[model samples]
Target: MSVLSDLKTVAVHRDFRKLFAVRLVSQCGDGMFQAGLATLFFFNPQNLATAAAVAGAFAILLLPFTLVAPFAGPLLDRWRRRQVLLGGNAIRVVLTLVLAVIMVTQGVSVAVYVLALVTLGVNRFLLAALSAGLPRVVPREQLLMANTLTPTLGAVSAVAGAGLGFLIGAISPAGVLKDGLTLTVAAVLFGCASALALRLGKDQLGPDRAATGRGRSWAEVAQDLRATAVDMADGARYLVRRRTPGMGLGVMAIHRFLYGVNFIALILISRNLLNDPADAGAGLATFGLLAGLSFAGNGLAIVLTPLAHERVRPSQWIVVCLLIGAVSQGLLAITPAFAMIVASAVLLGLSVQGAKIAVDTIVQRDTHDAFRGRAFSLYDMLYNAAFAGAAALAAAVLPDEGWSALVFAVLALVYVLLAVGYRAGIARIDDTPREVPVPQPLDEPTDLV
Candidate 1:
């Protein structure tokens, strides 16, 4: 009962409530649509054209980040965060509505799919903005725990959505139109999320934005960033001068690289081996349940992490998680049954969440708040971009082998490399000791449950 009471308290924290609801709605909507997508792709012969259309849509919608993220970094201070959050949700609303229309209309052309994907991708940009905004609302001490909760919610939402979808799908026939209906439900929740973002006043978080001597022209902003990185050479040099917090960037870099490969591996596994038209739908449904279980583990971690902070070193856990991931992939490859596959997913989830919590704790504990969001955003972009590139490369190179073997091999290489590298990185760290400047308990006494 005390444990249950504690969870309720954490859930009620005003900031967590607002952020968690928004992420849950958006992810739920995505899950529904994702299930809808699989059903349409594998089962329907006529709508085969729509698969490429959706892929094209993703390509179009996600361009905002590549184009605007750098500029947004500077404006992160200037723009009203509430408005940014609202804007992102509002864009998703528009996208979802149009998507619903396309789903309902038989005459809807391939262009509709493209538009929807792009719009959804744009909505994801808002996701990043929200993540950046979160640290401001929550105390620095609760940051890692707070961060974990959202992913945990996202996991739960995936399960709920998948269950809802399977139920809806049981009644409705497979098609783009059916998929759109599921999306519409999520869109309504997304709109509610937008309203919530708007209601959450911005001033509570840190300085709204630092005054950058009157805004620079677009070209001028670009020039300033280029020069800024160059100037940071001194700071960079200082960082490397003797390890400490300096290697935070290195850890982030490697973590992102490995994560990129993992994302690609998931894609190949789903698209290839999971292709049986019948299995495709069930796989999506079950994957959500498995993912939910993963998030539950993550939530448990969030609840328990600060208490364990002294015991769980980021470097130590990073190495352990990498090994776990490698072994899980091997397990996944050999597992013939659906139930076994899920067990493998749960293990992978545990390892992934643990490593992420530890690394994020390390970064936030060591870096000042001023550069925090920008540093995170930059890291996110690189890692995500790497995900696409790795997926594409894997797609091209592993044309023959089954996705299971391909996925296993990729995981094997990644974990093996990471484990080896961390060993070397750690030894080099002892020699340099200055690189990881702050290796201490990350939680604040006041903030812990």
Candidate 2:
């Protein structure tokens, strides 16, 4: 059966379908905005300057999440999960709509852009809550499928959204009236998607609050903070204490750090550095193509990994892929040529996606439902921090010539070492390679909380 068929079989019986639908909508809007924003900045009078500023702004937004995400688990534990998810989306929807409006109004300012980026970071934190909520909606056996599918479909949506963005931006007249209509329509879609995600039912969200009397003092809030600190420490300890989880997280973090560079480097390559002014549009077009293709390669792994991992040790696969990534990053470092770089990007795509899948599957298999949310979210926060830092550094430090690509290569090489040292006993599943089990209809609700 196709990967879609597999995911559908899981979705049909559980709350996963509901959550997945919400993810799809949210991802679509985000993808559109990312593509549209980059293209818009490219055309703006202060193109390079604003573009670089936006990258730094996004990095700032991400830093707060890294510092604050550990606190969210307790909030999520105490509050209604569904409401938390919905409210987060609501904030994000407004932020995104504002962005669309600012562009159409020709009133774009770096301040407003930075504010929107921060708002999206908050929204993304709530997304972490939503991720935690998933295992509660499905059976243990299907968690991997559900987790993989969410990101896979999200990557696919990004590709489609980028296309939609490019076609609309490229093909449509920039007259205020026409641009207004499109922005208005996209805003409406963003709103609807937020509402859909907000519809997380009360039954699923109903975690019992601790009784108010004794624990309600001002000191208790401090105590609560302390308790969260302890939990976070334990969670960190849990991840690092184990050979597999620690190794897996390290490799994945490196993947994200380089991937962030890949994103920014593409823009610099296609839009700024190319020599053939006549081919500027083509170069940028290929940038989008290569980027979307990398993500497409990511989505493809939802199917391919079942076969690929069966053929080789997951650790060996990760190191080999990282080595390949280092080569491509090195190639990109030296060349100003567009086509050669785009070809190199394709190889980078394959390497990054494979490493990501290997790391995630290994960790998830070792984790239990109770701590997975906090554990995974913590890992995610670390990875996002690395990614955000890399993005900012790419913006601030990239040489007029060979900066980001070389940095990317060095980062990939570090992961190559981590992957090589990964304890094989930890990352491997001992079963004979066989057809993946089709999830029985999601007949039962899992208490991920």
- Most accurate candidate by TM-score: 2
Q: lDDT for each of the candidates?
A: 0.55, 0.62
Model 2 per-residue lDDT tens digits across residues 1-449:
46868777787754777877777776666666666555545434444433375466457657767787776654554455666666666666667667666656765577555755665565566566656666667777776566556766766775776677667767777676444344444455567666885556754743343112233689987887887777677666666655565677776787778777766766655555653324446655766767766665575566665556557755656676777677766676665566667656767776777676666665656544444555666766776688788877777666533336456656556655654555343446332122222212212222222
Clashing pairs in 2: none
TM-score of every prediction relative to native: 0.74, 0.79
**Each candidate: RMSD:** 6.8, 6.2
Model 2 clash tally, residue pairs: 0
RMSD of 2: 6.2
- What's the distance in Å from true for residue 165, model 2? 2.8
Any idea what lDDT model 2 has? 0.62
Worst 10 residues of 2 by lDDT: 431-440
Best lDDT goes to which candidate?
2
Candidate 1 lDDT tens digits, 277-323: 23544444444455566556555555554455557566666677677
